[model samples]
Target: MKRRGVPPALLDAFLVLVALIDTWANVGFDRGAPLGCALLASFALVLRRHLPLTTFLLTLPTALVTDAVFATLVALYTLSSLNRHRVLLGICALTYAVIDFLPWPWSNLRATELAGTRNVVHILYSVASAAAPVFLGQLVQARRELSLRLSEITEARENERLLTAQSVLAKERAQLAREMHDVVSHQVSLIAVQAGALQVGSGDPETKSAAATIRRLSVQTLDELRHMVSVLRASGSRPTELTPQPSLADLQRLVDGSGIEAELKTDLPGDLPPATQRAVYRTVQEALTNVRKHAPGARAIVAIHHMNGTIGLTVTNTAPTQAPLPLPGAHHGLVGLRQRAELLGGSITSGPTSDGGYELHLELPIGTT
Candidate 1:
């Protein structure tokens, strides 16, 4: 409730002091009467923060009964600046009407010899007192509403800026993924092919030693590719090597060493595009890794089926004997994987399976594949 250049509490206290002074000035030497009115007005000021409506109600009666201009001004300002105008307006109108007709001590004084002169002064006093409060209250209320609207507009602009930043980030990551895939695939494939050929055909001991070095180099190159991909995906720095990415043909090997006795059934369509095949391979790789991490000691089943114009893959594992390792602070792994699949016009879902196991299913539409 602080305002520019002045704190709200301090401002309220100053207003209350002004109202008290006005009360004393208006009452004059009424033998403790002015003191009582000033105290009541000041006490009403303290209620401004928590019960502004009640404070306004309390002040309005004092304003109407007393001839204190500053007390009425403080009440009007609190209502308009701190509370809403519609309620303040209705209260002020009713209060003024009641005070105009009331049989007060001052009203009784205007009945006798000096009645004409006293009536003139009273009329002037009523016009100035009533009009000033109403005008100032409306002015303050309008300013408060304008400030609130401006704040709402500022918040909306900030949200738009945040959305724009996220969209730009997603596009940058997509471009990085494209560049890294192109660069690493060619280099790693060339190294693996050259190493395999030299290992089989070479006869010299030196050539044999060179082939072994090439094999180790090829493994290191693949590891480097994974690290670069993880970094680009905004997953954490640490790399976990689990079941390797399997092509359509590696279904048997995936099942054989999954650390659980299992079976794999595949009806993968031949002539699938290279990118689609890679996506499917990555999906299966992640699914198997999840099984090992979260469902250890549970026998699993892997299946890749071609149905209609889409490739569907499912991996299911029974409930594990022990709880899975707590995920290290790398929350972005699954998020990044889903983004990858979506870019290739595919979707993936992984969660607990019915019948006491977990399942992961991925689907890639044929046109995108």
Candidate 2:
């Protein structure tokens, strides 16, 4: 385990202290030359972390003369841990072994005295002192590299999981769009055809008007449904050719076909954007559909008022004279209209009128494509 709370400077000072004590014991401090070499070797420990090779070279001469083993061991450990240069480590280890084993004029006399009987023990001690620190440093380096690799692998797995989830969601959305186009579109088209036939066959003005409203609304619903289906199918692919969306000009055909007594009032620009025109057309269609379904035989007034930077639409119906038919309602028409308006940075509201009828109001920003 690594020591905590001990700063590097303090550790270096401790190594130097240990080296000084060992040098004094092995080679007397009374001799100026041997004492100076020992002090210089110990001082080199301060440079171990920043300049390990320089520190290792400085301690070689002292290791040959006196027993300044602490400073030599610390310098070797720093060189192995920080530099990671195998060639430099091999050269330093060889130099240290030669210096430690070879007899010299300034050699530690007490250690050299057991040269005959303790030769093997002396060799093992010298090798262990030199090799232990380097081995420990390499182990530490290996552990750090393993931890980094594990972290990178974990991050890659998480990213892959997120991408898989997104792909599944996209596939599900596309499937739903296909189902709506195949099932709901066919039924809505049938309703429009039946309403058109009813309008032609009915003799009463109220019945004809109601039938006409249903037909127009059904057609508009189909158009919007087609657009939604196309969008879902496109996903990330190239756009497919779509039918031309209806605009304000198509409102006349809608009103005429509605078979109801309805009036449209507007002075909209001839060059209004396509999106704005579509929104206006759909809003009117939904309101008329509600009138046909809930208040049959009611006269509807559609008023489009253009103001500075905004377009306002109001569809108001008088009280009904005939009862509503028991036709199946999807019940999502008004919710869809509200979502459409909000998407264009606009709003829509509808409620019962005091005159026992219903009214819907829409405010959409102009130039919003």
Candidate 3:
């Protein structure tokens, strides 16, 4: 875009006029001196915006006195629009004014005119020079501030875009988890119902044994599926009509149902919230399930401690003699457990113990339900 202020052509024309006037009015062997000075001043003015400091220095001498009015104006405008150092600019202006009026032979003017028309002209020149530089400096500073603000706005928009991307990814993950739960639960529920029916009937030895195995597998799969759904549904509000979760009070039933004997000890606070109790229960449930699947016939230990607005649950089981069976899909139970813990500012840690045993530990803030 074309910039504001005087155009180059107009400025060039003004310089030509000033040069011609200086050369014609003065009678001397060095007739082109004024013309040369005016042209140089105009050239400096034109390039002032790009190199402000140099332009200010270039115009400081002759321009301070006689015919370099345009040059002085240009230097001031350049200094103000570019350099931020006002004190430096002021010092330069004062120096130029002092030198312009000094009673020196090379200066080609006398002290007699110091308070005359010459003085008026010098005063006007000083004011214009200082004012233009200051004005341009303010404009430049405002432009810089505006640029900074624009950069901040752009950064904020980029951050918002990233957050939106993350939230979308989280939702997609939740949807996939929900779909998996549906597929697995449907098959497992059908198997469980059929097995239950068969067990009530024919007592053929093979059929009875096959039915019992089916019932066990089906029940286990259903429980795992339910846990998966619970984890997936962690984002929304708590389920209003959800069945009460088993806590320490029902720890015995959990161990008995899993067919893995759990030696349990509880020092739990009576005032523990339903959510804390439930988290403890689920940790134990998952721990026992892992024991059955990966540590078959191994004894398990469960412990609960409540203190200082925190509830800590631990479950450890001896390792199985056989190799662990690989499970399909992501570990939704652990994912849900972590998500639940994070929601309540809690944590869970699980790993193989030192003596060929596996342990699960969970901590939940009290009154966080």
TM-score of each: 0.52, 0.56, 0.43
Q: By lDDT, highest first, what's the ranking?
A: 2, 3, 1
TM-score of 1: 0.52
The ten-residue window of minimal lDDT in model 2 covers: 106-115
Candidate 2 matches the true fold with a TM-score of 0.56
Candidate 1 stretches with Cα past 4 Å from truth are 1-4, 32-35, 60-65, 85-88, 97-103, 106-128, 230-369
Residue-wise C-alpha lDDT for candidate 3, range 77-111, written one tens digit per residue: 65766676878778766666665445444556655
Worst 10 residues of 3 by lDDT: 20-29
Candidate 3, residue 45: lDDT: 59
Question: Judged by TM-score relative to the true structure, which candidate is superior, 2 or 3?
Answer: 2
Alpha-carbon error at 294 in model 2, in Å?
2.5
Candidate 2 residue pairs in clash (backbone atoms < 3 Å): 209-259, 212-258
Error of 3 at 99 (Å): 22
Per-residue lDDT of candidate 2, residues 1-369 (tens digit): 333678978877888888888887877778777677788888888898888889988888788777666678778888887767778787787678767866677444475465675777777777777778787767777776787788889889989998888788779879989898999999999999999999999999988877887888899889889888888777655767777778999987876666567898988886788888999999998898788778978999999989998999999999999998899988999899999999998999999999998999999999798
In angstroms, how far off is 18's CA in candidate 3? 38
Q: How does residue 39 of candidate 2 score in lDDT?
A: 82
Q: Count the backbone clashes (under 3 Å) in each candidate.
A: 0, 2, 6
Misplaced by over 4 Å in model 2 are 1-137, 174-178, 192-261, 266-285, 304-313, 326-349, 362-369
Model 3: pairs clashing at backbone N, Cα or C within 3 Å: 76-133, 80-133, 80-136, 80-137, 81-136, 81-137
